[model samples]
Each structure stands twice: as C-alpha cells, then as structure tokens.
Target: MITDPQGTILALFLAFCRMGGCVMMLPGFGSGRLPPQIRLFAAVAISMGVLPVLWDLIYPKASAPGATYIALIFTETLIGIVYGLIARLYTLGMQFAGTILAMSIGFTAPGGHDVVEDATENALTNLLTLTGLLLLFMMDFHHVVLRALVESYAATPVGAVIDSQKMLITLTDTLRASTMIMLRLASPFLIYGLMFNVAIGLVNKLAPQIPIFFISTPFLIMGGLFLMYLSIAALVRQYADGFAPIFTSF
Candidate 1:
C-alpha cells in the first residue's frame, strides 16, 4: 500500500483531502440535497479509488517535509478546485436558463424558492435545474467528469507551475460561454413568451371585458409544459454536445 511507506501515507492523505474537497463541491454530486456525511464518504471513496492508479504519476516526493511540501499541496488543491469549478460553471447554465424562462413567463417569484442554494428557486428554475441534473446523469456526464479529473493530473502536475493567469482566463471564457449557451437554450421560450404576451395584450385592449389574461393562463402553462417536454431530448443533446469541448479546451 502507498500508505505503508513512511511519510507516504501523510502525503497521500493530503492529496486525498484536496481531491475530496473538490469533489465535495463538484456539480452533480455536490449540488444535491444529500447529507454532508454521505457527500464526504463519496469524496473519500472516489479519492481512494483514484489514488492507486494515479499515485505514481502524480504523487509528490514525501521526503523532507517543509514549506515546499505545504506549498505543493496547496497548489494541488487549487488545481482540483479549478477543475471542479469548470463542471460547476457548466451546470449553472441550467440555473441561468431557468431564471430567464421564469422571468419571461411571469413565474418570477421571490418566494425564496426562486434560488437553489439559499432557499429554493422559482418553480420553473427548479424544474430546469432538476431536469438538467437528470440529463447529466442519464447521459453519463459524471463519467466524463471523472475522466477529466484524471486527465487534469496529466495536464497539470503536482508541484508544477500552475498558470493562474491561464486558469483565470479559461474560467472567464467558460463563464461567458455558459451564459451564452443558457441564453440560447431559453431563446425559444423567450420568443414565445414575448410574442404571446404581446398578442394577449392587444386582445385585452381590443376587448376590455374578455378577461383575456385569465383565460390565457391555462393555455400558456399547457403550451409551455408541452414545449418543454417536446424539446427535452434536444436540450439534453445540446448539453451533451457542449460538455465534450470543455475537457479538450482545458
């Protein structure tokens, strides 16, 4: 066992701590409403699983523990956090799209549920986020994420120079891209919502007594839900397609 060697176990534990921390904050696994204990267990399990395979290539020398070792561990942890953030940013696209769609359809409620972390997001936002998460798992995106984590060790080694500037640039670019993609995803709903509201407004103006707003509510909800159902497969496909280019970019 790697731990059998003196000081090796300590280094390995430090490595696992970094890996586990990152996983504890990763997109799918970290986002859900799971117990903290379970999440920690998962992180430990994953780190232990990967350590053996990756130890030789990524393991830093365990000799002469000092400031250099501490610095290297810190750097390694930062690298893991960066990798984790990439996936998290990608997952945030759904939240952005949901927010857009919610606002467009008059579902923008400040009922605390309109946010995922603090409380709850809007119903539409929650739906979108959950749907996106489901799609991620269904499409095996987590598998891709693990592969990327392994690949990251190759791309950015332990104790090596971490291009912080490059990491910042990459994160900013990814965030911008994610925003654009979210807008694109919600574009159809935006257009539809806009056009529908405009037409409804005109109808209300022409026939002031018709209660057009009341009548249209059912239609809008039904149509919106149906459209979501119809486009779900395409949406998932787009997400899957978008996910692939990111690993290579890093």
Candidate 2:
C-alpha cells in the first residue's frame, strides 16, 4: 500500500521546510522560551497533517529529486517565514503600545523578565503584553493564522519565484498599520500625560514657593491609573477588533 516511499518522504520534508520556517517566527509558538525540539516536532506534525491535502501540488514537483528540488525547498521556507512575520509584527505592536502606556502613565518600574518572553519589561508592560496575548489566544487567533498559512500554499505554491520587493512592501505596510493601531490604543494615556503635565506646570508658575512637581506625582499616577481602569476594557477590545482587518488585508 505504501508505494513510492522515497517520494512520499521527500514530499513530507518539503512540507516541513515551509511549516518549520513559519513556526520559527510565530508569536507564542516561536518564543525563545519554547524548546527547539518542540518546535521541530510541531512543524513535522503540521507538515504530515497538511501533506495529504497538498499532495497533488507537492508530490509531482517533489518526486523529481534534483537541483531544482533543492531550490523549491528554499523558496517554500521563505514564503512561510514571510507569512509568519506578518503576524509576529502585529503582536509586537501590542508590546510597543504597552511600553508607551507605561511611560505615559508614569508606571516606570524597573524592568523585569517578561511574562511570556525572555526580554526585560516593566510590570505594566508585562501585564499589558500578557493580557493582549491572552485575548488573542481567547479569540483563537492562532487558528486564524494557521488558516492563512494553509491558504498561502495555493497563492505562493511550492516553487514559485518569490518577489523580494513585494515581501518587503507587505512587511512595511504591516508595520505602518500596526504602528497606527498601537498609537490609537495608547492615545488616551498620551493625552492624559500631556494635560496633567501642563496643568502641573501652570500650578507651579502660580505658586513659585510650592514644590508642585513633588506634590503632583501621586495625583498624576492616581489619575492615570483610574483612567486606565475605566478604559482598559475598550482599549483591548479595540486592539482585538483591529487585528482581523489588518491581517486579512495582507
């Protein structure tokens, strides 16, 4: 029943090359904390699962083992990496928003190990990053990304000549969109910080004898925290809502 064993194996490996590349850059799955062995096994499993569906598309090209086959492996992996990076960029935008929120709200605690990644982040950043990622998981964002990956094979195929220029443009566009969304998420804090500082400055001018900066620190932080408490639900909801449009566009 198992005919063309070598061809089957070669096709499986071809599938692995693309999937492994994607997994290497996926957000939670590709975190530095995850063991390389686990990532390898995951890619292999995904490849095996998808191979049957893609066999007609892959096996014909793969059965001919030669220099061209090696080239196909390289191109397939690149295509997958590009797709993975698109999602990775969007998630990283959440971290950027967290950092902005921390600074704007004066929650500048010393950096500690990130809850999910090895990178050092302050408590607020860690909290927001973890919260946003948790929301993504709750919304089954990984499933959306995997669906995109599976659909990508039909678009890019196994051995098509990849347009490096187009790939670069797509990444740049994602960065732009992600930057805008993060800014929107952090805008309220930005405005609060600005207005609070301006009012503090005016108060200091009115009473030169009073150390307004020292007196205002607690109020500034308190007001920011209270505002965050009020708006956090909407903030993250907007964040989650924005992901779909951005990802689908690309």
Candidate 3:
C-alpha cells in the first residue's frame, strides 16, 4: 500500500503548492487575523484530503525530472492564485461599495480596527464587510469555493501550459462584473446624497445669511443613517446572493 512513499510525498507537496497558494490569498483563510500556522495546516490538510481523488492527474506530473517539476510547481501555484483572486476581488468590491455607501450617507467616522483585517476601516464599512462575510459563511459560500477548486483540475491540469492572457481576461471579467454589481448596490445612496445635497444647496442660496453648512450636516448624517438602517438587510442579502453567479460565470 505504501510502496511509492517518495512519489506520494512529492505528489502531496505538489498539491500543497497549489492549494497553499489559494489559501495564501483566500479571503477568510488568508486574513491577517488568522494565524499563519492555522492557514498552513489547513492547506496541507486540504491537499492531503484531495490527493486520492487527483492522484491519477498529479502523480505522473510530479515525476517530471528537475527542471520540469520546478516549472510545474510555478504553474500550479499561479493557477491557484488566479482562482483565489477571483473570489478575493469580489469581496474587495463589496468593501469598495461599502466605502461609497459610507461617504454618500455622510458616515465619515474615523477608521478603527477592522473586524476582519488588521488594518483600519470606517465604522460603517466595517459593519458592512463583517455582516456580508457572516452572511456568506452562513450560506456556505466556502463550500462553493472548495467545489470550484476540485473542478479546477479538469479546467487546468497539473502540467498544462499557463495561459496568461486567459487568466488576465478572467480577472478583468471578474472586476467588471463585480464593479457593476457594487455600483448597482451603492447607487441608491449615491442618488440620495446627490438629491439631498442639491436641495440643501438651493435652500442655502435662498437663505445665504443662514449657517446652512452647519445646519445641514446633522440632517445629512441622520438621513444617511436612517436610510442605511432601513436597507442594511437587503444590501447584505444582495451582496451574498451575487457572489455565486459572478464566481461561477468565469
């Protein structure tokens, strides 16, 4: 059963190269808050678990003489990074949308500790990002990603030629799709802010002597907060729903 210990170990490492690349860039797994040891172990475990299913595909390639094996390592790692970035870009897009929403509604609170990342984020943005991530986890989005990883072997085999153009196109398409979705989600607040500001401007023009700027600040923040409160549920719901279609499309 263990006749080919060397080959098996090599194959497992090759698998790890790919899976680890993905985990290195994958959102939750790669988050700065999670320990490196945990991510490393998770990648190793996933590679080992999937090895049997992919043995036929990986074992032979892992046997390549020195130069080829090294090349295969790079190729596999790049492919995995591409797959991970597809999902990463989508989440980053949501964060972008959140920032826009925050600005539109006048929630300019100072950046604080991010719930997910080690960096700073506005309170409103942090709320949106955390809530959206929680919803995605509750709906099992990671399962979808894991399924995609398994299916990717067929789409991109162990030693296949890495197509830079195709990968670039895939990333470009993901961004385009994600941008459109985020823009759609954030548009309502954008419009609301524009209209509110325009009306306020007109009022200012009519009553130039009044301290309109100071007076309108409170109203702007209050209105934005109220609107966000009313729509937060729907916003996060739509964000979680959009992930599958965008990810699966490419």
Best by lDDT: 3
Model 1 is weakest, by summed lDDT over 10 consecutive residues, at 109-118
For candidate 3, the 10 contiguous residues with the lowest summed lDDT are: 61-70
Local accuracy of candidate 2 as per-residue lDDT tens digits, 76-176 = 89888988898889989989998898888788878999877888988877777778878988998877877787888788888877889999999999999
Give the TM-score comparing model 1 with the true structure, all chains together: 0.85
**Candidates' C-alpha lDDT:** 0.74, 0.87, 0.90
In the range 72-147, model 1's lDDT, one tens digit per residue, is 7778778778777888898888888878776666664564543335466677777777777777778787777778
Question: All predictions: root-mean-square deviation over Cα?
Answer: 2.8, 1.2, 1.0
- On TM-score, the stronger of 2 and 3 is 3
Weakest 10 consecutive residues of candidate 2 by summed lDDT = 124-133
Count clashing pairs, candidate 2: 0
The C-alpha stretches of model 1 lying farther than 4 A from their native spots are: 1-4, 108-118, 204-212
Residue lDDT tens for model 3, 29-120: 88999999999999999999999999999999876558888888888889889888998899888789989998998889889998888999
- lDDT, candidate 3, at 229: 88
Native-vs-model 2 lDDT? 0.87
Q: How would the candidate models be sorted by TM-score, starting from the highest? A: 3, 2, 1
